[model samples]
Target chain A: MKFNVKIEVMLKPGHSDPEGETTARALRELNYPIESVSVSKVYMVVLEAGSKAEAEKMADGMCRRLLANPTKDDYRFEIRETR
Target chain B: MKFNVKIEVMLKPGHSDPEGETTARALRELNYPIESVSVSKVYMVVLEAGSKAEAEKMADGMCRRLLANPTKDDYRFEIRETR
Candidate 1:
């Protein structure tokens, strides 16, 4: 079976987001009336697995091991069976 | 009023996703049985706007002008009123 996995990884609260801050400043300069900005990475993975549960498990493991930094990032994911 | 905007930016269908491909290769090397991978950028913006519609409009404009490359990337956003 094959599964499609979507994972979102973002910096934990209180972590400094320089890129986001810069973007917010730029928006303000453009007169966008923005208060703040936060950025995240979304990963879409298509993989072969025994089942949706197995796919989710593998994706979660991938997040913990490589996709997210435990000290500063948080991650979440959803898995669906695919053709 | 304040609005929370979530924007997702991704490469168009025909564009090559080098980062995603590299990540997928790494996962395969780790024995994850992955077929392919795609990556996107998600922006969480907290801003003040006259209304949700106005917020959405501003966010859409932002995506078009700066956040996404019109030729190779596509973007979508949702806006919600925030306290």
Candidate 2:
């Protein structure tokens, strides 16, 4: 079966997000009246694995090695069985 | 209106992704029986702006300046009015 997994990674509180902050500043310049703006990184990974346990292992490996910087960002994920 | 913007950034074909490649290798070690796996980055942006045109402008700016490296990534986005 194929599983669709979505992972989100975001800077931990007190961590500088110069990119997001710069973006918010630019939006304000455009007269956006921006109430709030938050930016996060997302990953969409599709994997064909034999079993749920194996899939979970793959997901964990993916997150630790590439999908996130554990020291700077917190990550979360959702997995959907797409047959 | 509040706009929910989803941005996807991907390495252009032929671009080397050492991180993702390393991840794939790790998955293999886990006995995933992985037929194939493709990974892409996703961004969920919530922005409260005054107008759609301004929102579009902000989105473009965000993508070019930070969300992606134009030289290495191809990006596409969707904007939905959520409120």
Candidate 3:
């Protein structure tokens, strides 16, 4: 079976985003009235596994181990089974 | 005026994604029958700028400079004006 998963990782509110800040500064240089912006990383994965339950368990482990930092950031994921 | 922009940055096809690869390996360890997966970053920005043209120009510049790397990545952005 094949599964499509979309993972969104975001910094917890109040945590500074230097990459976003840098981009905002560049926007100002380009003459934008940008005040604030929030940026996060998104990951979409498609894979084949034995079953939905098995896939979910493995995918969840991947997130907890590497895809996300449980301390300062939060992650939400959506999984879809492909026909 | 306020514009809502969604930017999706993807690695040029054929580029090796170590992060994705690492996650895949971990998945195998977790007993998943995973074969392959692709991962990329997504950024959504909401900002207030002077005008549509200026906002577009600034947003474009920001993407070119920081939101994307000129070498191996391509980006697609959508802009919407908020009432």
Candidate 4:
């Protein structure tokens, strides 16, 4: 079966987000009343696996091995069968 | 009222995704059977607006003004009430 996975990777709280802060500043400068902005990365991947359980395991492994930084980032993913 | 807005910005089809390509190659090297990977940016913004309609308008303006590139990127957003 083919599984489509969506993964979101975000920095843990207390970490400074320069890009988001800069973005917010730019927006406020443009006269939009905004409190704060935070940014994250989303990954959409397509892969082959035998079953849903196997696909979930593979997705988890991918996150641990390559998608996120253990010390600084938190990541989660959702999987769905693809035609 | 305060609104939490989630915005996603992605490269439109036909644009090269060097980051996604490099990530997929790294995952494959680690022995994962992955077909393709595409990455997008997600922004979580908190701001004050008079009502849902106003919040939506503000979010849309943000996307149009800075969150996405008109020629190469597509963006969508979701807004929800927050304490």
Worst 10 residues of 2 chain B by lDDT: B30-39
Candidate 1 reference-contact recovery: 0.93
- Which rank order by lDDT, best down to worst? 4, 1, 3, 2
Supply the TM-score for candidate 4. Answer: 0.98
Q: DockQ ranking from best to worst? A: 1, 4, 3, 2
Residue A23 in model 2: lDDT: 63
Query: Which candidate has the top score in TM-score?
Result: 4
Ranking of predictions according to TM-score:
4, 1, 3, 2
**C-alpha displacement of B9 in model 4, angstroms?**
0.3
Q: For model 2, name the residue pairs that clash.
A: A42-B42
How do the residues B9-81 of candidate 3 rate in per-residue lDDT, one tens digit apiece?
A: 8888888888778867876676656676667776667788777776677678777977788788888887888
lDDT by residue (B1-83, candidate 2, tens digit) is: 78888778888878887766665676667654444444566666777767777778777877787667988998888888885
What DockQ does every candidate get?
A: 0.93, 0.33, 0.53, 0.93
Error of 3 at A17 (Å): 1.6
B1-83 in candidate 1: lDDT tens per residue?
A: 98899999999998999999999999888889988999999999999888778888899889988899999999999888875
Question: Could you give the CAPRI-style class of model 3?
Answer: medium
Can you write out model 2's per-residue Cα lDDT over A1-83, one digit (the tens) per residue?
A: 78877777777877877776676677667654554455676655677866667777777877787667889888888888886
Evaluate model 3 with DockQ and give the value: 0.53
Deviation of model 2 at B1, angstroms? 3.6
Clashing pairs in 1: none
Cα RMSD of all models vs. native, in order, equals 0.8, 4.4, 2.9, 0.7
